[model samples]
Target chain A: MLAIFKREMRAYFTSPVGYMFCAIFYAVSGFLFMLNTVQAGESANYASYFSILLFLFIVIIPLLTMKLVSEERKMKTDQLIMTAPVTLFDIVMGKYLAALTMFGSAFLSSSILYYIPLAIYGKPNAGLYIGCVIGVFLVGSAFISIGIFISSLTENQFISAFGTIGAIIFLLFVSALNSFINNEAIRNFLNGLSITTRYTYFSNGILRYDSLLYFISLSAVFLFFTVRVFERRRWSKS
Target chain B: MIKVEHLTKQYGDRYAVNDISFEVKKGEIVGFLGPNGAGKSTTMNILTGYLSSTSGKAMVDGLDILEHPLAVKKKVGFLPETPPLYLEMTVKEYLNFIYDLKKCTLNRKEHILEVCKVVKIEDTMNRMIKNLSKGYRQRVGIAGAIIGNPEVIIFDEPTNGLDPKQIIDIRNLIRELGKERTIILSTHILSEVKAVCDRILIINEGKIVADELTENIEGALRGNRRLAIRIEGPSSSVLSSIKKIAGVIYADISVEHEDGSATFIVESKNNVDLRKPIFYMLAKNSWPILSLEFTGANLEDIFISVVDEADAEATVGKK
Candidate 1:
C-alpha cells in the first residue's frame, strides 16, 4: 500500500495532472479570495470561503482522481499491479489516500493564503473556522471517493470525470429542490439527504454528529465499492 | 513447479479453454505454441491468478492459485501479451516499484543492478519508459518479470512485435533465464520454441493436440502421415491398389524398377496414419513390400496439419 501510495504521488507530480490540479485549486480559490475579501478589506477566514468553494470541489477533485485507476486500466498497467503480490485493498486504499492527500495539499495551500490575513487582522471565530474546515474536508473526501469509484467503472478519463461531476451535482442539488415540498417533514428529510445542507451546520460554528456520520459513511461506502469493482473484475470481465 | 488440472474457462456460452491440463517440472522450459485466440493468454492469466478458471485448479510450487493467490503470485512472474509498463516513470523507479509491489526481500540496489545487467537495460535506467524504443521497453518488461528472482516465469509472446535482431536477443535472454528457473512461454512461431523450449505443447482451438520434446517434434512430424513405399508388384496395379486404401489422399509411382517393383509416394488426409492400412492392403493382395519410409516435413507443415486436424475433428463432432 505504501508503495502504491508513493508511486501515485510521484505520477501526480511528474505529469501535468498534479500541478494542474493544484494550480486550478489555487487560482479559483484565489479568485474567490480576491472578489469576496481582498478588495473589500475583509480579512478572509478561509473556512467559510472554503465552504462556498466546496461546490467547485466537483471540478478539481476529478482532476486529482480522474486517472487514478481508469488510466491504469486503459494502459493495461493494471495487470502488473494486480498480478503482483499485493491485495486489492492495498491498491484501492493506496490510491484513495494519495488522492485524499492531493486534496489535502490544495486545502493546505489555500489555508496558508487565507490564514496569513486572518493572523494579521482581528481574530476569526475559532469554533466556526474549525467546524467549517472539518465540513469542507469531509465534503472533499466524499467527493474524491465518488470520483475514484466512478473512475474504477470506466477506462476513459473524460467519462470518469463527467460521471463524477454528474453524481456530485445530484447530491449537492437536492437541497435547493427541497423547498418545493409542501410537508415540513419531507422538506427536512430531503435536506438531510443533501450534502450542501449538512455544511450549513458546520458553517455556523456547530459540528453536527449526524452530518459527520453521513459524509464518513458515504466515503466508506464508495471506497468499499471501488475495491469490489476491482475484485469482481478479476473474477469476471470489465 | 507448475501444474494445471482439467482447467475450463467459460464466457457466456463459449468455452475459452476446455479441460486443459499441462505441467512444467522444476528447471524446465515449456512452450505453449498456438495461433491467436487459442487460449494461450487465457491459460497464462489463470496460472498467474489474474483470472479465475470456471472449474479446475492451477498450482505453483504446491500452492493453489485460487486458494493462495498471493503465495502463488510471489512464486510466479508473468509478462502478458503487452508489457504492463508505467510510461510516466523512469525505468529505475518502475523497477523499484515492481520490487516493492512484489514485496521482494532482495537487496534493492544490487538486485536492480543485476536485473538491469541481465536484460542489458542498465544504461536506460534513468530514461522514462515512454521515451524508450519498443525493444528497450520489451527489455524493461523482461527485466520486470525476472526481478525478485522468481521460481517460475511465464511470458505470453515475449517477442510478438520485435524485429529479427530484438527477437534473437530476447530468445537468448529466455534461454539464459531458463537455466535456473522453470519457465513457460507461449508463441505462434514454431522456431521460437525450437530455439528456447525443452518441450512444446501445441494448443489448437483451446485444446492440447501435441506435447513433444523439441528434439522429438521433428521426428514426430516425419512419422506423421507421408510415406514412401517400395512395393514388389506391377506399377499400375501398385498405384491403383494404394489409391483404393482409406485415408490415402494421393499416390503416384516415383521410381520404376525393372524387376516389377517400384517406389511410390503416398499422401494421406490430416492425422491419418496410413502406414498400417497400406501394409495390410498390400499383404492381403499378396504384394510384398520392398521398403517403407516417412518423407520428413519441416515444423511449419506439422503445425498446420495439427491445427487442421483439430478443426476437422471439431466439425465432425458437431455433426
Candidate 2:
C-alpha cells in the first residue's frame, strides 16, 4: 500500500498533472482571497474564502482523482497490481491517500496565505480560522473519495472526471433543494444528506460531532464503495 | 506446481470456459493452444485469481485461488494478453514498482539488476517505457513477471505483438525460465508451442480436446500422413474396406467425379503407409485405382482438426 502511494505521488510530479493542479488551485484561491476579503477589507473573514473555494472543489477534485484507477485500467497496468500479492483494499487506499496528500499540499499553501494576512494585519480568531481550514479539508476529502469511486466505475478518464464533477455538484445541490420538497421529513432527510450542510457546522466555529462524523463516514463510505467496485469486478464483468 | 479441477467460467449463459481441467508439475513448461475466445485467457485469469471460476476450482501450489488468493498470487506470476505496463515510468522505475508491488524480500537494487540482465534490458533501464518500442516494452513486462521469481508463471499470448526475432527471443527466454519454474503459456501459434513447450494442452471451446507430451504431438502429427486416392468402386464398400486396413485410422470418400471415380482421404496411424494395403484391398475388390498421394499432418493440421472436431461435436449435441 505504501509503495502504491509513493509511486502514485511520483506519477503526479513526473507528469504535468501535479503542477497544473497546484497552479490552478493556488491561482484560484489567491484570486478569491484577493477579491472576497482583501479588496472588500473584511478582516478575519476566512470562512467566506473557504466557502468560495468549496465550489471550485468540483473542478479540481477530479484533477486529483480522475486518473486514480481509470488510467491503470486504460493502460492495462491494473493486471500488474491485481496479480500481485496485495489486496484490493490496499491498492484503493494507497491511491486515495496519494490524492489526499496532493489536496493537502494545496490546502497547506493556501493556509500559508491566510497566515501572512494574520501576521501583518488585525488578528483573526484562531479557533474560527482553524475550524474553517478543517472544514475545507473535510469537504475536500469527501469529494476526493467520491472522485476515486467515480474513477473506479469507468476506464475513460474524461468520463470519470465529468462523472465525478456531476456527482459532487448533485450532492452539493441537494441542500439548496430543500424548499422544493413538500414533506418536512423528506426535506430534512435531503438536507442531512447534503455534504455542504455538514461542512457549514465546522466553518461556523462549532465542533459538531455529527458533522465531523458525517465527513469521516462519508469518506469511508465512498472508499468502501470504491473497493467493492474493484472486488466485484474480479468475479463479474464490468 | 499447478492443478485445475473442472474449472468453469460462464458469462451469462455462455461458457467462456466449461469444465476444463489440467495440471502442471513443477519445472514443466506447458503450452495452452487455442484459437481466439477459446477460453485460454479466461482459464489463465482464473488460475491467477484475477477472475473467479463460477463452478470449479483452480489451485496454485496446492492453495485454492479463492480461499488463499494472496498466498497463491504470491507464488505465481502472470503476464496477461496485453503487457500491463505503466508507460509514464522509466524501465528501472517500473521494475522497482513491481518489486515493491510484489513485496519481494530480495535486495531491491540487485534484484532489479538481475531481472534486467535476464531480460536483456539492462541498457534500457533508465529509458522511459513510453519511449521504448513494443518489443522492449514486452521484455519489461516479462521482467516484471519474474521479479519475485515465483514458483509458477503464466503468460497469456506473451509474444502476440512481437516481431519474428523478438518472438524467438521470448521463446528462448521462456525456455530458460522453464528450467526451474512451472510455466503455463497460452498461444494460438502452433509453432511457438512446438518450439518451447515440454507438454501441450489443446483447448477448443472451453474444453481440453487434446493433452499430450510435446514430443508425442510432434511424433503423432508429423509421422501420420493423410492419403488421398481416386478409385473406381462403390463408395461405401471402398471406404469400409480401406478402414479395415491395419494402419488406416480414418477413411472417407470426399468426392465422386463424373467418371464414377471417388476421391478418398485416408488418415494413417503412427506414420504407417496404407497405400500398399489399400491398393491390394481395392485390387481384391476389382476396383481400379487411378491416383494415390500423401500429405503429412503438420501442427496446423492437428490444431485445426482438434478444434474443428470439438465444434462438430458441439453442433451435433445442439441438434
Best by DockQ: 2
Question: Candidate 1, residues A1-238: lDDT per residue as tens digits?
Answer: 9999999999999999999988888888888866666665655445557666887887888888889999999999998988999998899999999999999877866766686676677577767767777888899999899999999999999999999888888888888887677899988888877898888888887888988899999999999999999988877832
Error of 1 at A96 (Å): 0.7
TM-scores for chain B, in order? 0.80, 0.81
Per-residue CA lDDT of candidate 1, range B1-319, in tens? 8989999988877887889988889999999999999999999998998888889989998999988989999998989899999998999999999999998999999999999999999999999999999999999999999999999999999999999999999999999999999999999999999999999999987789889999988767554466888999878987998899888888998898888899999988547889898889888989999999988477888899888989999999999
What are the models' TM-scores?
Answer: 0.87, 0.89
Worst 10 residues of 2 chain A by lDDT: A36-45
Residue A38 Cα positional deviation in candidate 1, in Å, after optimal superposition = 3.5
Candidate 1 similarity to native, TM-score: 0.87
Model 2 segments beyond 4 Å from truth? A42-44, B218-268, B271-294
Docking class of 1: medium
